[model samples]
Target chain A: MRGLLFSAAICLATSPALSDPLPSWGSTENKSTIISFVESVTDPTSPDYVTPADRIAVFDNDGTLWGEQPVYFQLIYALDRLKTKAEADPSILTSDILRAAAEGDLETVAAGGVEGLLEILAVSHSGMSVDAFQDDVRAWLDEARHPTTDMRYDAMIYQPMLELLSYLRDEGFQTWIVSGGGVHFIRAFAESAYNIPPEQVIGSAGPTEYVDGQVMKLPGIDFVDDKEGKPVGIDSRIGKRPIIAGGNSDGDFAMLEYTTAGDGPRLGILVHHTDAEREFAYDREGHIGVLNRGLDEGPDRGWVIVDMARDWEQVWPE
Target chain B: MRGLLFSAAICLATSPALSDPLPSWGSTENKSTIISFVESVTDPTSPDYVTPADRIAVFDNDGTLWGEQPVYFQLIYALDRLKTKAEADPSILTSDILRAAAEGDLETVAAGGVEGLLEILAVSHSGMSVDAFQDDVRAWLDEARHPTTDMRYDAMIYQPMLELLSYLRDEGFQTWIVSGGGVHFIRAFAESAYNIPPEQVIGSAGPTEYVDGQVMKLPGIDFVDDKEGKPVGIDSRIGKRPIIAGGNSDGDFAMLEYTTAGDGPRLGILVHHTDAEREFAYDREGHIGVLNRGLDEGPDRGWVIVDMARDWEQVWPE
Candidate 1:
């Protein structure tokens, strides 16, 4: 369900007396476009009006909803898990890849590639019940702060994006996070951090097994919600193509392509992180959430490009 | 969204003058229990009250909601596809397995096992756009008839189950179909047949490929929503444990167990097809949707087993 405040408030961009729906977003094209699209779609008198059930909006998580600088946050969580598990059992360090991961040997871990990453992930996440895994993730998220800025990871979420999500929800839209990150990790905090419940969060998943009357995580990746996989996930899980989709990277290119390509009044958006003064700025050669092709073709493809440096009055949520 | 009738519905089980919500269901405990459960959960003053958003109920499609006897309709559709394709491109008949499948050789197909079945599915389903596949399924459903009964496959759906679905929806519940059937096949008629939109149908899925800027079905089965996979699929897709679950096979044991094991007012139901005169009755030795373990352990586990011979007043919709 949408939040209780949804029915409790009325948001009008033209009315100065009403609450500003997107306070953190500057009065730029990015902000106005969002307000206009929502208003036109929700107006009962307009032909562009969409029913509440058809008002679906999907967002990418890693770099779009939260910071993914230095490296992807999930990778950091996996590395930390290696250290903690090794300290407890030490026997888990017997595997060469696990041992390297435990020792913080990034070079060796990188050399192992997808196979090595999956091996490390298996060791770190498997052998636990679904509840236990969720609890473990919750506990870690509560304490884990970004190394660069020392801010809690949830606090690193973009203020403007948060406003946009809430505003969309207020307009009778069912907002969803379509992420490339691990599903369980995102589920643990998404409800609290984004007000988007676990049910509405779609992401990459590790295989799950039901053993001894409990659902447990398995070693290997079952589905990846990156690149082309996003549309697949949306079709299978949501069973409907989203009318509005936003992401910050090329990994989400297909998702944006699929979402906006649908008939009539669809919105596709990209967040361009060009604010080096606030957050790290890298695109073509960025280690995470590379925005190369999206940047080059975004305007040509009719996607709204939110220039992070110019579109926002603030970045991270305080 | 639940239908608009829900807002207009005012259910009071005690009132005799009100229109019977489930006209196809007899006054047996199977029907009464369902009504009572719904009443208690929906009563504002009752301790069993569950909010509208939390009133999630899941149903299995194959046998519980519709007929799966004489082989699943999806398999039949796949076989028809094999024959039609073999006619167009005679060279496709060269593969022994494909030829056997096209010839309706059940003995040989069964001997080929799950791997062989997937091979047949890949050949039958792949290389088509999502829209094209959906249209193909819709066309097949329109013309395909049961071999013996000569009834349209969709016409074989249990009237009582359809009433239950609508009644549950009328009670402010979000009804979902969690099946082992292919989602596309179900989506083609689910809304028309049961009033359930595609967004609420979860099923076995093949991998999806994004090609030529369109999402298309890939050849192989990516995940099977049977046995242990039921609970896993429910967790990933619904993101919440359903309060009520129903099915007709041992394959659904995990789903019923998981749904009812949770705290608070929960219900597990099994549809026992014991009416040989109206519908085929088979249990332990049946080829499809066998009901051996669920029949034996249902009562002990507090599951409500509906005897089709006694509980249903009407079998199929007139």
Candidate 2:
């Protein structure tokens, strides 16, 4: 039994499948520049060196780290939730978003705008305890498939960004996600997906209340953590100003501003989605993942605008 | 030069202060019981073992981790802020709390109850960005001394609790301070004083808003994070339900209840302030730090009620 167990263990340890390395995304000048700057800051002998305490890096979620092609993944979750709820409660069909969602016309529902989105979200998100909501998110992620990609939303995460997160961690940098998405929803998957722990994820939050005689937290959509609230959420949650920040839109402009304004070897990179072949390519005029003012002003502010067409060889995990 | 450097390094490495073993605080029966329970749950070989990912411990700040006599430390900070603000604008003297504050009568102002406290906290905590508030907290902590003890507020922390935090961390437990005090105020000292990071500190928070192009997160007097809010804040911020909880008042009873109700080997401890000679001995009917319901029902619920007078040889750091 011992000899058989030893052989099995040796096979497991040396197996090609178990030891398979992460796919290589050919390096670019942009990647090298980012790596070099981080190296200088992390190296103790360097003049611009920073300690582990000072090594804070923030990344935007939607288009920057993951594919946000067929609308935001959160919106899709909200839509599916709307459909399910509508089936249980026929009265929900009277709601405009629900009606559109029941018909599977996501485009029409989205076109109904922010109010429509908020209505869908408020109904789907509220009335559940925080733990219940987390479990719901975990369950949904486990089974929910993206509409366009037909893959698990988590698997659609950009492989290159995952590599960056790992590389930064190896260099003692604490990585964080500063998103406009719901804090708890992202927190549920961030740890297992990116290796960034829940404590490090700062995002949109709602007011929460405890039910009497229960150990549950319920979230109410009172505060949307986007635009100016992005910087605020980061300040309130992380306390430390980020030394490195990555984002893809004008919504993330404030975070980029706050991070780059800090003294020291700071870095601000904007992932410009300009690959129409593999991904969408629209900067100033794109309705989804809009990058208007940020694209116009990034070069002047010394922020590197990552051209997706030229920079990344692949966008999603194989 | 190399030979001399090597000799100096060797001498420093072999220095008595670096090499000599320190004396142990003879682990009493109480300490052993607590350590043994924690070890059994945390040790993988033990049947009751818990994973490191699930090892969560929560602590109360004020009277449990530190001394909060004569006045709550944050209240003292508020009074000082009131005096400073009043000095600049004598018009603030028209306010009841400010008037009492100006006359050096804090008890009179506080007697107005929660409303009075809120007024004082509003003027003291608001109208500043989160970063500015943190800086002010740091500055105040540096200069401020406790009224009765004449010691720095940070120094008033119980040395045993500080050791407990380190011990818990060494045993793979993530320790958090879930207090009724302002989160940022506790966060300012927690990292340096107890090694608990800012993200791990959850407290009563006032509604925060974005004003004048900056994010202002302030404490509101209305949102007392006591009673029901304790569990609410814990669930919202920590995400994971704590396995171990330490507290001292009726305000913390809800937290203890929330923690102990979890499955498996959980521990809940209540610190009874029974050391009038060394500290202060007042509970149940006491106006401050009341421990009425918890004291009576703790044992029935399997919570360990720590008798401070009898259980501890030392209170605060000398």
Candidate 3:
């Protein structure tokens, strides 16, 4: 009888209803707000109830889901790949920007600006089959580590964000990743890292050609899924406005605005990275993931600005 | 006792396992092949068993799903819209092609060729918000009927194909529509007509802009999801090659080839429209959806050419 009672207690404690849905989220107003929003939309009796089919939650990939300090992870992968290619064929690094990128000269590459960055990306990412490029990305992810943290890129994914994703999915919301990063680059690890499927990911893409039977990535910019492009990407890809939009920078401001501006119940979340001890912290003046406009007007728009240092009990998974 | 037995009998007759999954499909080789392929992939004991996540099935929309006879339904819609716009402002129809389209002169428009057709499509389809365009399409679909059949375009959807879709879905395969038609146009009716969602429907798209807060359609082709473009679009959008591909035209040749060429068990289906009594029968030499390459190579590639007149017991929903 005692054994039975003990077992029952254990079951009760571990049960889905009793257990914390977002264990990494600290006991804060933001946590409660997120839970309340999800519950209100999921409860059939609630006026804010949304159908499972209509319960879409979109998230930005870089910085929002994982760390993107120093540089975007995709750029790191591209530079590393470019270096290997240049070693095999030195003529491939014709331009100074290409040579700088291949040599891991971040300062010189940064000075080259957007055009040079695009050129480097096009040269590094294209000329290979889509299958081959994805394979290379997978291989790099398996071997590569972050410059500062010495941790695998996938391992840097936010534990709190993962919990939020699971909780939303538990409440019948479909989670999608809308990123300014390369679509192919994000797709390579999104499923395993964040539980987001390839089809559910929308991002900047380059032109691809179907040569014989294989689809080959081509040299050139096709579309940029950033800033104003975020809204356009969401509309074209998902064909439905998300009920919830989560991001960490101004790149996602349009996405969050578009989502919240829709009729009925909506929520916009901006993860303010302020945990200098656990994770890198920079926002207003940062070169990457600058949050000037978002920081200024987010609170006024009824958007929840989450302080990572205060709201998260844990940064990364155990 | 008699009533109870009768109730039991009715239950057995109506049971999913006992009832025919594809009742509209005749007891043909094509039907058997489809069933066998689905069962093989779904059965855990089978060597060809595929996980649910990888069980993707792609389908072409237009003539493959419904009728594209007199012309593509979208062109018909475009002409009708052009006529209305011309009525409001006669100056809008400045070009010869535009005037011909507005006056329902399809012969003259056809003579104007692809360039003229694109011009007509751009003028009629663009310069409106995505939401407004979809709403306009919905309104048009509600009132419009086929000039010859006098049946609603949505009603002309194949019954056998509908059953096939439901069956594949039951077997845990995700169904997607890869069409050459306008993405916005197909999205308007796809959900209601085929039980396929807007996001699952990939098609040719025009440029869109994010103005103020709305995603407005702009004049110009963004990407054409036809011929070789089909494979490119599938790769960019879905990010996975489908296990099963169904199409009725040369435009889908690349897509079908790409799917079948992928490693492991795969199936390609070509719907041969031989049901002149119920639908259009033109194929190899038809102006739209020409199947010169498909008809010649399909059999050699182990593709199941579905003879609509013989394989289907019913053409359209009653």
Provide the TM-score for each candidate, comma-separated.
0.91, 0.88, 0.96
Output DockQ, candidate 2: 0.38
Greater DockQ among 1 and 2 belongs to 1
Among all candidates shown, the one with the greatest TM-score: 3
**Candidate numbers sorted by TM-score from highest down:** 3, 1, 2
| CAPRI verdict (incorrect, acceptable, medium, high) for model 2 | acceptable
DockQ of 3: 0.71
Q: Which stretches of candidate 1 lie over 4 Å from their true place?
A: A1-19, A44-49, A95-97, A103-108, B1-20, B43-47, B51-53, B105-112
- For model 2, the superposed segments whose C-alpha errors exceed 4 Å read A1-25, A212-219, B1-29, B207-224
Q: What is the TM-score of candidate 1?
A: 0.91
Looking at candidate 1, what is the lDDT of residue A176? 93
Candidate 3 segments whose C-alpha is farther than 4 A from its true place: A1-15, B1-16
True contacts kept of 3: 0.68
Top candidate on DockQ is: 3
Candidate 3 per-residue C-alpha lDDT over A13-132 given as tens digits, one digit per residue, 9 for 90 to 100 = 875566789999989999999999998998899999999989999999899999998899999998998899899999988899999999999999999998888889887899999889
State the TM-score, rounded to 2 decimals, of chain A in model 3.
Answer: 0.95
For B1-318, candidate 2 gives per-residue lDDT tens digits of 466557667877864335312112233555666777777987789999998877899999999998878778888888888789888988866676668866669779768788877777788888787768878988999999877677888888877777677777767889989898987788778888888877678777776665544567665643467877888767656666788999999989889998888778888888888988978887887566899889889988888888877777677766
Instruction: Report, for every candidate in turn, its global Cα lDDT versus the true structure.
Output: 0.86, 0.78, 0.91
TM-score of 3: 0.96
Put down candidate 2 lDDT per residue, A201-304, tens digits, no spaces: 77776667756535443334655667777776676666667889999999889888888887888999999988888777777875677998898898898898
